[model samples]
Target: MITVDFSLFPVGPGDRVLDLGCGGGRHAFEVYRRGADIVAFDQNENDLAEVADMFAAMRAAGEAPAESEAAAETVTGDALDTPFGDDSFDRVIASEIFEHIPHDTAAMAELHRVLRPGGIAAVTVPSWLPERLCWALSEDYHTNEGGHVRIYTRAELEAKLKAAGFLIGPHHHAHALHAPYWWIKCAVGTSNEDHPLASAYHRMLVWDMMKAPKTTRTTERLLNPLIGKSVVVYLRKPHRGSAESTG
Candidate 1:
């Protein structure tokens, strides 16, 4: 499910976009469909391979625009040190990834380094309240290999972005419907991925995403203010001369 809203990100056609730590290329796919030149960057070789193949498949299937030929590439590298040159992209999306890196600042700095002046970054993390509840219910949520390493309060995350030289912009909650399912999973067992109840909830989420029923949409709207699963912050790197303008 997408936790970041591209409308808030403001990417137009022909923009160069990077999806940092793009696990399975979910967001990257959306950017490509929007006609942005996309790069799905991740450290997982298997995931990169799949993303590359999917890009080819998408091209053949005409899933994108006729000019969708701008195409996406899979770049495998560390988040703290990407292979591209400085100021290499018009937009960057590092969703649901900051918490995984122990040195999240370095990763944020890398994001800043690669963005052109006025470029936007959309960073999503587990929202504080729901995430705290998950951790309270299950230690495994935090301890699992490559699982979420920490929970972020919006303030802390925004502050870190500011320190990395981004002008913190609009921010909000997302994935409100996914929070309860996670709570159920954590209450049961993090590894119990196939348990009947958890499995049912998982399928329901897939349906909610794939079909987007009105009922789930209404439910998500209601719960967003209360127990949203993800916190998304939009930020931008300032032009050299305009750093003081934010003041």
Candidate 2:
């Protein structure tokens, strides 16, 4: 499921976008469909291979605007040490990645260095309360390898971004329904897929994502502010001669 809202970080034709830590390439695919040149950068070679295949499939299917300058590619690399030149991308997406990084500050700095002046970065992480609940419910949830290493409070997230030289912008919560689902999984056993409650919840979530019925949509909207699973923050690099840049 996509976490970053496009309204907060709009991409259009000819925009060069980087989906850092692209994982399964969900956001990168969306960026491509929006007519932006997208690079799905991840450390996993297998994942990048799949992402590259999807890009080819998307091109054949005419998913992106034919007349636009949209293109898609996959890059495998370390987030702390990306191979991009300075100010290479017009927009950057760092969704659901910071929590997994031990050197998040370095990664954030790389994000700032690669994005063009005034370019936007859309970052998402597990929200405080829901994530805390998960941790409290099960040690396995956070302790697993390649899993979330730290929980981010909104203030801390903004502070880190500011320290990285990004101008913080609007913030919002998403996926309220998924919060309870994760809590249930933590309560029962993180890996126990066949547990009745966990399985039922998974089915509901899959249905909600695929069908997007009005009932769940409205319910999530109402509940998001209080218990959303993910919080998305938009940030921008200061333009040349702006206050942050000049300093």
lDDT of each: 0.88, 0.93
lDDT of 2 by residue, 1-247 (tens): 8899998789988799999999999999999998899999999999999999988888889887663467788888999999999999999999999999999999999999999998999999999999999999999999999999999999999999999999888899999999999999999999999999999999999999999999999999999999999999999899988876321
Candidate 1 residue lDDT tens string, 167-214: 988877888888889999999998898889999999988888889999
**CA RMSD of all predictions:** 1.6, 2.1
Candidate 1 has its poorest 10 consecutive residues by lDDT at: 63-72
Question: Candidate 1 has what TM-score?
Answer: 0.95
Q: Please, what's the RMSD in Å of model 2? A: 2.1
Candidate 1 stretches greater than 4 Å from native = 66-68, 244-247
Say what the RMSD of model 1 is.
Answer: 1.6
For each candidate, what TM-score against the reference? 0.95, 0.96
lDDT of 1 at 244: 43
Clash totals, every prediction: 0, 0
